[model samples]
Target: MEFLLYKVHGSMNTFFMLEGEEREDYEEMTLKLAALDPGIDGLLVVLPSQVADAKMRVINRDGSEASMCGNGLRCVARYVCERDGVEEAVIETMKASLHVKKEQPQGDGIAMYAVEISPVSFQMADLPMAYGGETEWKLKPLPFVSEEIPFTAVAVPNPHLIGIVPDEYQSNPAHQQKWAEFFNGPNEYFTDGVNVSYATKVEGGIFVKTFERGVGFTNACGTAMTASALVSCLAGLVPYGEVAVYNPGGMVKCSVEKNGSSFRLRLTGNATYLAKQQFKWEGTSSESGLELAEELQEQALYEKFIEQTSAVTNRFVS
Candidate 1:
């Protein structure tokens, strides 16, 4: 049967979003759909949820399911809210049920949304990163990388290893990629792998690049950027309020507040829809052929909007 789907992005971390229920082969199918031209970071499977507006399942290109994906969550939030005719809704993710609300458009044809990324924890047991049996991993020199560069681990429900690095290393893709791959691949620190990011403070805000766990070197990883914002604040890299985060794909404004012991993060960015299509999903990934239905041109407007943002000049490669 033919099924409708969307090509969506938040800060250029693209995904193919489709409505579906629980399935056994979703991982395999994600690998197929994410391989489309101008490849996607992953596939977002929006499912019916009894507890919330919708359930968002993020399947990475390598066929691994993520506990949480903030970028994918924003796209799914827009899709379900528009479908069900709601302005605000709570999305059920693997780790937490998140609140999402539509916002004033960032630009012409560019829809904006803000979603909560939380249940934040600094405890090493939460991320389960092995580091000298420490309870919390924060601003400590990890000898593997460099003593000069200190790393912090945060689980915004997605384990992220954020290292506050020098501007030269942050701008160096090779340097970041090497460390990310090492940690993600049978390493001593992160056995199950980790979403690795190298961030550096810049005028106005911070510039971040992430090498995602299942997907390597994405233009952006929403949870990673959110974690970076929080860690930057904890490390006194930036003031503990609103900060603009620039990535290779685009920019998002993040704010972290101390909510008792744990923290709370809110991510606001463009949830731009690029195109819509229909595909025959006859149960197998190989047989499902995608047919382009319409181009929304939201991507063009998003690009224009990013160009207008203040931090665009500080943007660099991932």
Candidate 2:
């Protein structure tokens, strides 16, 4: 019944952190909390060291579980570091090890945190894509989606299909949604599962819209960001090594290097801290958005809570 909630604002997105309860089924809690706080776009769970056997889960606000999330980990790492006062910490997720470190605080009250996502995989066993068994394939024109597209298929702890879109389509919401539907819709091609991305190059970096599996189109996605950067580089869209990924949620830094036949992706960013409180629900529950907002407002003390806690500032290149 008891839970600890932490909130973090990252480069391009926001995350809700959950911890403290040993018996709480986090997978279920993610959905419960998302219903309770619809404003939250993503959720991260940190299992106690005592219960190391339990796998950590990251759930999108829509109640879909992602195999891995790059931006979410940075935010979660920042939350953990701020609370534990440790410069470096290791937080385990559903798939890989998230090594996080807190740097010096900036003047704007923003503290930078670095997170290293394990690596990338292209083995048919690793990416598990039904297509040819992962022989270093780039996203080429595909008739399946009925689009002649240049894409990159990589396994950066998760399977993703990253495609570059024209500048015109990049800014169009309807076009983005159409692609999202194609990747997530009922189809025999990506039966096991796949996330699709439409990326466009801009002045500073690349802007991407991702239709993720388990979760639909979310504000930001880490693995998608990594795949975008890699695909961009391989297709000569961008330089290799470090790249900027702009998603609806926020911006994330992606770094990649050739590893044998595939590549490795490392994402780095920040997570913010939000207010924490206890919730007492009575009577039948309603799934209406208005009801959830009302419940959250009751727990929010506003001015009083702000006075008690120091605000965590967010800084972006924009």
Off by over 4 Å in 1: 283-286, 309-315
Query: Tens-digit lDDT track for model 2 on 108-191?
Result: 444556666666765545665555544655667555554756766677777777777776565555755675576566764455
lDDT agreement with native, every candidate: 0.85, 0.62
Estimate candidate 2's alpha-carbon lDDT, on a 0 to 1 scale.
Answer: 0.62
Q: Model 1: clashing residue pairs?
A: none
State which candidate has the highest lDDT: 1
Error of 2 at 170 (Å): 0.9
Q: Per-residue error at 33 for model 2, in Å?
A: 2.3
Cα displacement (Å) at residue 7, model 1: 0.4
Q: Model 1 Cα displacement at 202 (Å)?
A: 1.0
Worst 10 residues of 2 by lDDT: 309-318
